[model samples]
Target chain A: MDIGQTLYWIGLAGCAVFAISGALAAAEKQHDIMSFILLGVVTGIGGGTVRDLILDRPVFWLVDPLYLEVCIAAAGLTFFAARKIKFKHKALVWMDAAGMALFSIMAAQISQQWHASWMVAMVMAMITASFGGIIRDVLLDQMPVVLEPEIYVSASLLGALGYLLTCSFQGVEDGSANYLALAIGFSIAFSVRGAAIIWDLRLPKFPPPAAE
Target chain B: MDIGQTLYWIGLAGCAVFAISGALAAAEKQHDIMSFILLGVVTGIGGGTVRDLILDRPVFWLVDPLYLEVCIAAAGLTFFAARKIKFKHKALVWMDAAGMALFSIMAAQISQQWHASWMVAMVMAMITASFGGIIRDVLLDQMPVVLEPEIYVSASLLGALGYLLTCSFQGVEDGSANYLALAIGFSIAFSVRGAAIIWDLRLPKFPPPAAE
Candidate 1:
């Protein structure tokens, strides 16, 4: 596939995965159908919405109705399928990792197109890859997983830096370089997150000071 | 007092009121101190944050520490004082109306400064006046009050248009026009909301269509 098509498919898959994960999360809370749909739609589009707002563009889903339709379908599918599935927590973690990996690279690419600084690009990528879950948790009245000592934002940061470094490399053809960079970015994020889960790795904690 | 000082005090009072409203709302949910603080901060600054993000400026509260300090104090005091307060709901609605009015005028003034079209300015004003509460509701896992068949967005819309009309007539001489416009705008919103509450007024709803 061409670079553009590859990116499109990756994003679509990411959206679907995120929608499923969101539905599952809502199911854990025993929310009603409308609430589940709301979570699914927000999780599917949240990253891109934040990115577009920051970029001062009309939101991507608003521009394309298909994104909304897909989210709706995914929410319905997830709601029914969740009842039949076991080990849902494991599936949720991996699906979230996949979504984060895909969105981080996509956000970085869009930022580069806007000619923003690398720092800005990276920040956008992290926000795009992470804020959806944060919003989902906050809306569910739970503390966000981002605030937990996980490899969440850290993994996205690594992926974004990988994409940036790949863009800076010479002698690679344009089409080949884009795919390679995206693949590398996704792999980095996915691998880090998977390893963190398996190894139970965590970032250092900041203990609250004792009150007098 | 000069118009600027008047606006300053009004905005501060609005922030304090919104913060108390947020604290009360969270208290109803039985949220802990941290969540209460977070909700209060969001309710007080959320509208301006949406405005700045849309305008592509650094978030206003982040740029101005005074806003953050005020929100924190408002939440802290509200936490202690809520038990002693009667008619909390009445106070919240009134304060929210004042905040909405001030923000609508301020948003219009800012948009005019940017030299945007009047339509864009009005839209910005409405967004600035209503988005915080919308966001607070959404984050609290409730349907956005704006999307409900309520007078919320309509009130902001009317207030914004009132500010615009006043500006067109009186011009922005010595900022007097600004505060006067805001007062008129707030009065309009408050009156409309009060009428809606008293009369149980609701927007028209369409009946469900026949089955396909």
Candidate 2:
């Protein structure tokens, strides 16, 4: 398949994974189906929507609402199937990790295509990968995992950095090397996030103020 | 003043008020100055940024960064002055109300100018007024006031509806009636919100499911 087709599938998979993860999270709240659907769609689209806005590009879902359709379908499916699923929390974390990995690389690629500086690309990648889950957590009134002492955003940042470095070294010729970069970036993000989840890795916390 | 100039001033005032309100909210967390600035700016711009993205307009801050400058300045001022302010919570609520009042009307007007349907305008106004505070609360790990069964989004919706109704009746010729519409819409939103704050009004909550 051509690079564009491959990226398109990756983007679709990312959206579906994020949507399912959102539904899984919402399930813990025992919210109604409508709420499940709302949360799912928001989680799926939130990251990319922000990235597009910042880059002044047409919103991805708006440009091709198939993405939205996919999220809604995924949410509906999860709503019914979630009852049968054991280990939901673990499933949610794993799905979220996959979504983060996929989205970070896709966003970094888009940012590079838009000719954004590496710094901007990295930031955009982090936003694209993490903002969806952040929105879900915020709406659910849970502390956002990114704000937790976790390695989530760090993993995304590393993934984006890895992708940019690969692109820089391999030259941006839009060839097979692009696929290699995507694989490397995705592997870095997923592995880091997976390890963090397994080991319960945490970032250092700020020391309490001296007076406190 | 011309209607355009008047609306411009109102928009700027809205940004500043929201920024101050954000800093006040962040103060309760005892975060660092940088966190204060981050929260303030996000709260000031979050709503309108979403609106612009949805409406396919150049983001206001991106097009003219003066709005960002205003938010940063307001945040900085609030950080230094917050300790001396009596009734910090009350001050935050009032500032937030003012921002909501101003931004709702401004967003409705913009939506109308963009030829959005009245329904779309109302929804956009709600988003523009409420999303900023929602974002601030999310970041601070507090329940968003809008989702607390308060009359926040309702007030914003009413403000936008009032503005649209006035525009329809008064004609959209950009005349003195436009000023009157702005005043009427602002008063409606502010009074509704003020009354809610004073009375501690709340929307009815859904009953718990039978099993629970």
Candidate 3:
């Protein structure tokens, strides 16, 4: 498959993974099935939706049915399987990292395809990787992970920036470069996030104001 | 000014109002100036941004600096003034209602200008009115007002639908129709919200699930 098609499929896999996490979140809230589907769809496509919106392009899910189908199916599957799932928190964090890495790389590459500046590409990468979870957290009335002390946003930022800078050679074909960037970016981001999950890596909190 | 220009100016006013409300929300949390500015910008343009995104159009703030400028000014002004202001809770609700009404009506009209279906227009109306507050509440880690015990989302929906239906007369010119619709929609929405604030109008919550 071409780079575009590969990103498309990989992005769908990311969506499914994100949808699973969203469904799991809704399950934690003890929300009904409809809420599960809603959260799943929102988390699955929310980032790409934000990206497409900013780029003046058609929203991916609205333009195509497949993404929504995958998200819904994932939500349904997760909802049913959640009862039997062990170590749910650990599973969730790892799956979320996988989805974030996949989405961030794809978003950065696609933004580059749109001829966006690297800054815009980085912002799109962060949004694509994090906005869905943000939306899910908002709906569930919980603090979003992106705003928490985890290394998630920084990981996505570094992954997108590093991938772009490292793959700037003119001689390399676009398709191969894209795949290489995706692999390298995903590896770097997933590793950082996995470290955060395992080691409780965090940005230091601000000290309280001195006697106000 | 023509209908389009009138709507543009009114929308900017709405942005400022929303920005002020966002700043007020940040003040309630005693967040830093940066958080205040972030919330202000997000709340000021967030609803319209969502509308543009869903419609596959360029983001409003990204396309025009005016929106961002207003949001920043409001945020900065409110940040400095917030300490002097007391009894803020009452003022916050009124200002929020105003912003919601203005945004809802303007969004409905703009959606119609894009030749969107009435259903799409209504949805846009709701998004444009409520999403900002949702963002603000999420940032503050509170239950969003739209989902809270108040006649919020339904008020926007009714106002948009009522205004469009009422303005669909053969003799009215397009400009007059838009103005009339805006007035009618804003009035309808604002009145419902005002009553809700005064009377604590709310959708009846489902009684806690009986023993699971």
Candidate topping DockQ = 3
Judged by DockQ cut-offs, is candidate 3 incorrect, acceptable, medium or high?
A: incorrect
lDDT digits (tens) for residues B50-98 of candidate 3: 8887776677765666777788799878877776677778778888999
Fnat per candidate, as a fraction, reads 0.07, 0.15, 0.15
For model 1, residues A41-156, the per-residue Cα lDDT tens digits are 99999989988876776898888778888888898888878888888888888889889989998888887776666666776787798778877887778756654556677788
Candidate 1 lDDT score at position B189: 70
Lowest summed lDDT window (length 10), candidate 1 chain A: A203-212
Query: Cα miss at A111, model 2 (Å)?
Result: 3.7
Interface RMSD of each: 8.6, 5.4, 5.2
- Chain B TM-score, model 1, reads 0.87
Q: Against the correct fold, how does model 2 do in TM-score?
A: 0.61
Each prediction's TM-score against the native? 0.57, 0.61, 0.63
The pairs that clash in candidate 3 are none
Which sequence of candidate numbers ranks them by DockQ, best first? 3, 2, 1
